[model samples]
Target: ALTWWNSHVRIVGNDAADVMTWIELKKKMADTYCPRNEMKKIESEFWNLEVQEESDRVERYIGGLPDSIHGSVTASKPKTMQEATEMTTGLMDKKICTYAERQAANKRKFEDTSRNNQGQQQPPKRQDVAREYAAGSGSRPLCPKCNFNHDGPCTPRCYKCNKIGHLSHDCRSPTNANVAKNLRGNGAGQKVTCYKCGAQGHFK
Candidate 1:
């Protein structure tokens, strides 16, 4: 192989000397030593070669790209390997800008959500405040017998025993006549007195 290469270089002496770069040297060597059929086979393989994991060619190109810049790279429709590489190199600034813009938008959204939540935390309503104040401040005194808060006159009557102090459910006494009387407190036999005029049969 060495004898053949020397003889070939001698036959093409001036052409070999003209090889100024690595690329030119490689091209000259391939043209001289490589068979025409082998070159054609290698060219076929080079064009058809693909990444095993990635099925789509475009996806293979942009697979390593950040999501924010993927769309722009794919939209340019680069036709050659060199063109695609050039496009990616040219978009470095745009990729960074897009990523920073997305992060800024997310931060703004979080701040707005926090602001809205803070705004929604309103003061208590008038009725609720008044109810709490009345209960807490001893404005309406609690009945000592039943522990009931009352604004007017009230009797601690038990439904089960027709007596004072405990409610019907909490009455200690067994079932008796008073239990039946308490059940009939609002029955037809009882008088319906009007509080406004001290009258019966109709409400004031």
Candidate 2:
């Protein structure tokens, strides 16, 4: 009869229907005085299978954690799915905050270094100064005596005319001309004497 029942039983698509059919089959076998030890063995196998499946699911979830903090989470050695999930979440939050703080500090340090470099004064190069002068942006050199810009080379001033670029000895003033005329003619009509050569003809 059992063999006929097993042959007639059709495989079902619904999980609940399959389970019900299995329970019915087990009840029939029990009624036929199946050994109790065999029944216990079957129940133990089902329990072990369920436990193995749950363990695999939890391990896969743990493996999915971020690699950066994966070691830290694993080091915690969480025993359950819920513990592992909670620990990973907390560690990730802390790591993110720490990274943000480090980035902010680096930004501030860079800004300070930039500001310090800007504040430090650098001496102008001679070439750059020459370039500026050539570009007509630089000021001309001032004359120490006149306190004015001198376009040409600074030279002694003419005492008679009080003008720069010519010496007093080369001055074309009227006073020097008068002195020359007086030296050339004595008041008494005597011949002018050359002071350097002691000659009676030309004045030195």
Residues 1-204, candidate 1: write the lDDT tens digits. Answer: 567557767887957655657786677577768978998999999999876642355567776777766677788876665666788877887768888999999999999999999989989998787567657857667765555466766566775456776776666654443333444675767755443344555434
Model 1 scores a TM of 0.31
- TM-score of every prediction relative to native: 0.31, 0.42
Shift in Å, residue 5, candidate 2? 45
Among these predictions, the greatest TM-score belongs to 2
Off by over 4 Å in 1: 1-80, 90-96, 116-121, 138-140, 143-204
Runs in model 2 deviating more than 4 A are 1-54, 137-150, 154-204
- Poorest lDDT segment (10 consecutive residues) of candidate 2: 8-17
